[model samples]
Target: MSEVLTTDMDRDALNNDGFRLSVISSTAVLLEQFSAVYDNYPSYLEIFSPIKCQCGKLPVNNYPESLQKQIQRLVNNITEGMETQRKPLVMQKKKPPPLKMFEPKIEEVFDDRKKRKGGSKEINEKQKLVHKYKKEMKGAIREIRKDSYMIAQVQFQEQQEKYASFFLLTLTVLLLLSMGYKIKWL
Candidate 1:
């Protein structure tokens, strides 16, 4: 959500020391508009500006050159000012990022189907890539469903652990009380 910011863009940049630009839409038009007119790349135009909220899309690979420079400068200044933040930010925890856990790599999926001895015609390069990725995911999902025994085993083990913990707690309390009563000759 971009503010009108005085309905004046270039003028504001030239006149005022600080100017704000908010993305009105997350379309390429807004990106292109800024790219064509402003001296920045299409990517950083919105980010470099004082963005209040997401006007449309989240991020882009291409941004205005000036905007990119501004962002770089801002990041450099911040990093220089606060050297401590880099350690945790750059050298993250030992665990891999959360996203890595969910999906199997597309390459791994395709490698499993290497023995296609039957006739297989070549597909359009773009479509082949897309098809390969889709088939990989589709097959992985089907394979997961086929492993019902492993799934049931996991479920049974989870339930057993829950009951075992509950039983252990109850037995401990009983043992403590019985010992105390026996010590008093009850």
Candidate 2:
């Protein structure tokens, strides 16, 4: 007979169980603390309870029966453990110091105002310079556009003149060739 070896899947299951146990312990500790606090103020439990469930049943009822039983058992164990491990709670005598809020000094406010005024003046001067440069650039662009239009017009006129001259020269040569052929000048 051969013995079966445990695989990584088994290790994973063990790891998960360990993780679940840690989570349960931590949760139980928190619940234990909350229970103590709630005992001091019974109204807290009333406020913490769910108001209504959409399913018309308690939220816990939504869980499977076995899981619910397991949860109840876990809670019971936690309560027992807490009863054994927890120490008696003590009331505090001295309260923590109240927080101090920041208030700006008069001189600091005045200094900030002075700085803002100087900064605004510089900003205004830079804006005016920018506006001036923008106007100059726009004017330059307009002049360049006009010059380009004028150059294009001149080139078009030159092209038209060349075409017209070529047409007139061809007409004259054809007329001369016809006259020579009629006079028998081959």
Candidate 3:
């Protein structure tokens, strides 16, 4: 879905200061042609520029003495400017608060196992009592649910019988009215 823009087609579409960009297949040919036309074109393009090393220093030995100094100065200026632009890491030391210590007043009174041995019997009895109550409550709940279901069924049957009786009475009345004076009923 990308739109292709050609210099010929977009010549009048763009403003006067617009740049017409085209892909050059032969960069060496293009450079050579430009060099022949303009003698200082390579200086402006910096074709023989020195590459910066991993340590931020440029390889200036291949360049001339004047260019080596210029490159060194440029690298220094760049590093200085970067350092000035960056915020320095200010490390502040923090001291932790001291721990608190205290001494206990009371000493060992009696062995806890003896007390627990007597209390365990009472706890078992309480647990049995709670279990017995829970079983009885579950039985009572089941009985109550059964009784409620039976009551609901009885009420439903009574409603059905009432509806059937009302329907029969209405049918008999309608039949008698439709018969006019042709029927003889007591």
Candidate 4:
């Protein structure tokens, strides 16, 4: 900015004081320009047209090349410095704590065991009922089998008596015919 002011066609001496004054003036000009452009970047882009400075020169067009270079250097320095300042993030994966270590040996264990045993008393009674039903069903099946065997034996004896009676009737008729033939009663 200081270089920009001393760089005016009318300004001959470019001393430190002249440079300081020019910088101050350039700052004021820069503020105005920023405010105008700060409304929007597109608005700033519009102001890229020749900006006139108080030195009777267009500020943007007549801006000293050295000052533009200095501005570029300042921007690069700031960005690089900020990059160095950022700390590297190390992500740490946390593992869950070992699952509830070891079961406690307490009186509750004995109490639960006794309670479970007491409940099983009812289960024993139900089991007894199941056993009794099984025994009764087995006895009924045995009685049915014995009655079936007795009925079959009676039926077999009846069939044998019928066949014997038929054989005896046939024998008596043959004996009568033989006696008639011997008496010549043909």
Winning model by lDDT: 2
The CA lDDT of each predicted structure is 0.52, 0.60, 0.55, 0.58
In candidate 1, how many Å is residue 160 off? 0.8
Q: TM-scores for all candidates?
A: 0.21, 0.32, 0.33, 0.30
Write candidate 1's Cα lDDT for 1-186 as tens digits.
135444576556645423222231233334444433443333343443433133224342355555555444444433333332322237645876566457655664455465443454554455668779999999999889879778999999999999999999879878988788432433
lDDT of 4 by residue, 63-141 (tens): 5666555444433433333333334577768976788879877773345633343547779788778779999999999
- TM-score for predicted model 3 compared with the true structure: 0.33
Q: What is the lDDT of candidate 3?
A: 0.55
State the lDDT of candidate 2 residue by residue for 1-186, as single tens digits. Answer: 113426776657656645655564565466546555654443543433331121124244655565455456545543443444334578778898889979766563345633343557779788778879999999999999999999999999999999999999878878988788433445
Count backbone overlaps in model 2. Answer: 0
**Residue 57, candidate 1: alpha-carbon lDDT:** 41
Residue 162 lDDT (model 4) = 97
Q: Rank the candidates by lDDT, best first.
A: 2, 4, 3, 1
Across 1-186, the per-residue lDDT of candidate 3 in tens digits comes to 125555655655553322211111133235334434543332422432232232145344644575555545544533333333334567657766668769678888888854443557789788778879999999999999999999999999999999999999879878888988454568
Better of 1 and 3 by lDDT: 3
Angstrom error of the Cα, residue 73, model 2: value is 99
